[model samples]
Target: MPIKSIKKARKLIREKRKCVNASQWFCQISLAFFLAAILTNQLAYAFFDIAFLGELSTALQQAKVVWNVLMYFIPGLLMILAATALVMAGINGVVAFCYKQQLASLKRGEG
Candidate 1:
């Protein structure tokens, strides 16, 4: 029946909306991660001139080494994660567009 088809179309529209929402969240999170990565990378570069390196205790020196390693490593990981999220967001947007087109065709009695 036409009513049944309408209900199904409505459901599809709801699903499309959900996908849009998820895509938006992924984009926002990706932006946040990208910003964090940039900040972390800048921090790594900014603190390289340790004038008091010789005055630090052994533990402090070890801590500095760990900090340097992590600062360099975490940004690369964050960038990768951000790229993944952006890709997911793009996929979701594409899915939502597909749902929208399907709903449109259903409205035209094409499916």
Candidate 2:
């Protein structure tokens, strides 16, 4: 093919959106994990003051059901977010791979 023809060829391959989105998903997951750790650590210290902690400790110890449910809920939400991000990254990766293949075929004049 002529240089002009190649330059004018409009392949459907995404330039950056798919790769960028895939990386963003991974970045979101990483940020979520980091924030979760920081918040959990800060909450632990804040909840451990000798005077103020006593009340919550007593309540939590007495009310096992609520404490257990709350304990599970936060982690459950984080896990859900992580799972969703991972699925999105997978989808973007698949799309980018297909796009790459199509572009490669076009390069060889096979498309």
Candidate 3:
């Protein structure tokens, strides 16, 4: 009801909004990186296929066998990395939100 309380409420709201916005931005950036990694990997595989196919030979067949083995494991490794990043981002966002809520409550002398 008082001016001081009004000012405190406004400040708390601003801080909470900033935290939420930051979390949203972080999520967007993480998703962009995930998509970029997937697309680039696909593009690399396509390029390798095109180049190797154009110059097919006995030696090339042996090389392809080794390359395919590497490629088979690369996707799994990329997926693990991506999953870790996603989990970290989600945890960060949740922590930020919790902190923001606590700040708001503290400003109101409720906690």
Candidate 4:
């Protein structure tokens, strides 16, 4: 009930809000990178396939096949990263919401 305790609680809530904002920004950046990597890999495979078919050299054909196989793996990696980011964002949101609710209860003298 003291003034100092209330001030400290407000300060802690403000810090938590800042952390939540930072986490949101990080999640957005990570998602952007995941999408970009997927798109780039797809485009690379398409272009390489066309180029390889046009030349038809033995070595080039083999390399193209290998590259295509590698491209297939990229989506799996992207999905994993995307899933991780989603979970992290969800957890951060829950924590932020709980903290906000606590602050509200404190204001109501219900803590």
Among the numbered candidates, top lDDT falls to: 1
The global C-alpha lDDT for each of the candidates, from Candidate 1 onward, is 0.90, 0.62, 0.70, 0.77
Indicate the residue-level lDDT of 6 in model 2. 67
Which RMSD values do the candidates have, in order? 2.4, 4.4, 4.4, 2.5
lDDT of 1 by residue, 38-104 (tens): 9989877777555334578888888888887888899999999999999999999999999999998
lDDT of 2: 0.62
lDDT for residue 60 in candidate 3, whole number 0-100: 85
* Segments in model 2 whose C-alpha atoms lie over 4 Å from true places: 1-16, 30-64
| Clash count of each predicted structure | 0, 0, 0, 0
lDDT tens digits by residue: candidate 3, 13-107:
67667766766766676676668668767876996778686767998889888877766566656666666666766776777677677666766
| lDDT score, candidate 3 | 0.70
lDDT of 2 by residue, 13-60 (tens): 345365767667776885686578557645644554432444456566
Specify the highest-TM-score model's number.
Answer: 1
Worst 10 residues of 4 by lDDT: 47-56
Per-prediction TM-score, please? Answer: 0.83, 0.60, 0.56, 0.74
Taking the tens digit of each residue's C-alpha lDDT, what string does model 4 give over 10-110?
Answer: 87699679769967976996687689668968787787767666556888778877878767677667767777777778778887888887788777777
Ten contiguous residues with the weakest lDDT in model 3: 72-81
Q: Choose 3 or 4, whichever is better by lDDT.
A: 4
